[model samples]
Target: MQDNDITVLVVEDDDIDYMTVKRSFSKRKIMNPMVRAIDGVEALELLKGKKIGYPYIILLDLKMPRMGGLEFLEKLRADSELKDTVVFVLTTSKDEDDIHYSYEKNVAGYFLKEEASDSMMSLVDMLDGYWRIVQFPTK
Candidate 1:
């Protein structure tokens, strides 16, 4: 479940942001499999029936079409099966309400997209070590 061994599902709607992350990964030489979902609906659909190995972390955006991040989080949290999955809000929003709400939802972390860019590789590297030691349930 190392960073490279973990699958990162990025639930972001912005094309530019998606590309930025992609490019950053390449530049940083992160070997993890990265999945992209344009919105909440698509993200959920992509997750259906997927049996990903544990220590998987979700990089979620708070705003999008079909369903916003908060709504998505609510629904995701409601499902017992997905409750243990770790999620971090990776967004451009600096709004206090958004931050508070995400934390209230029990998100593992709240990361600002802009600030994250500066040390994206470092963060990914750190995740590599931690994920390798963690475990998740499988059905």
Candidate 2:
């Protein structure tokens, strides 16, 4: 399927999880470009340096080294240029605080990665629909 113009920026630490997401999209024939960053630090650099363009959405994982998703969200929101960037929390963490804090950071949505492959497949399907109708801020 052809995505309008949305690119998925996946900020994940685990290789297996990352591959799971990629496989889901591939299986569905979704053609949206996927950029992967192992952790929040690299994710920030990618955003700051213009590696990934505007009109993109981030799929963030909560637990990661160097800087976790929450800290990244803090920095993202604090920056005037990147403050309004859309983010979706996709993590295995189901803690109450993580959920509450993620939404507090203005994340578009939150998803749990419980079943790994199956969950990722469902998540991919949902995201396909989301980007289809959603108009991202073009910075």
Candidate 3:
């Protein structure tokens, strides 16, 4: 699949972080469509609805006002339809337990939010290259 064929579902509550990601995408010229959710509950709603298409990757944050990322991952994994969805944890939490739990839930990767914007741009670049070569299951 091509990079444009992949969508990014950013499940985060921090306005700054969200904007940072948006800025990073813009700076890197990553034109992939992006959808934002304030928390896990909203993310789930969007996923269950038809607003976003398949072959999407989730950039999930672990902490939020409502349902947290781990809770969301649990619910998501329980659902057969969404269990195989690709998810990457992007959060400020550096707790080992959080990392363990996220990996246990089968996240694609875990990243710290303290990373520099240059790092973020690199991440976007990597993701663009990744989606271009990887294949996602048809929904």
Candidate 4:
């Protein structure tokens, strides 16, 4: 990957959902490297350990086995080194409280899984366009 390429960290526990995302990216010919985590705990390990490259964005799911997306966001925002990280929530939850709290934690955007159930084209396209034009702070 190029230095400017934005790595996508997908924190999803469901195998089907993860495959759907991968298929979408493949179909769209999105070349950015993707990193997967089964849950928030693993996601934290990657981020805190700097396993993924800089200029990355997280596509977070709200429900999971260990730590859910909200808790991950809480820890992410609290960490001085990662507070500025950008996150977008993608989940099956339509709960109003989930939406409210996700934004409260400063997620860049929130999308329901139903929106991308077919091909995930919409989400993939948006992310493609996003990383193309967005800027990140230098470390």
Question: TM-score of each candidate?
Answer: 0.84, 0.93, 0.95, 0.94
Worst 10 residues of 1 by lDDT: 47-56
User: Model 3: residues >4 Å from true position, as ranges?
Assistant: none
Judge candidate 4 against the unseen true structure and give its global Cα lDDT, from 0 to 1. 0.90
Candidate 3: tens digits of C-alpha lDDT, residues 85-107: 99999989999999999999999
Off by over 4 Å in 1: 1-3, 51-55, 137-139
Task: Please give, for residues 7-87, the per-residue lDDT of candidate 2 as tens digits.
Answer: 889999999989888888999899888999999999999999989955788999999999999999999999988999989
**How far in Å is the alpha carbon of 83 misplaced in model 3?**
0.3
Worst 10 residues of 4 by lDDT: 114-123
lDDT of 1 by residue, 97-122 (tens): 99999988899888777655666666
Q: Against the hidden true structure, what lDDT does model 2 obtain?
A: 0.88
- The TM-score measured for candidate 3 stands at 0.95
lDDT of 4 by residue, 1-139 (tens): 3433888999999998999889899998888889999999999999999999888999999999889999999999999999989999999899999999999999999998885355368888888888777878887
TM-score of candidate 1 on Cα atoms, chains taken together:
0.84
The lDDT, on a scale of 0 to 1, for candidate 3 is 0.90
How far residue 91's Cα lies from its native spot in candidate 1, in Å, is: 0.7
What local lDDT score does residue 80 receive in model 4, on the 0 to 100 scale? 95
Q: In terms of TM-score, how similar is model 2 to the real structure?
A: 0.93
**Which lDDT values do the candidates have, in the order given?**
0.78, 0.88, 0.90, 0.90
Residue runs of model 4 more than 4 Å from their true location after superposition: 1-4, 115-119
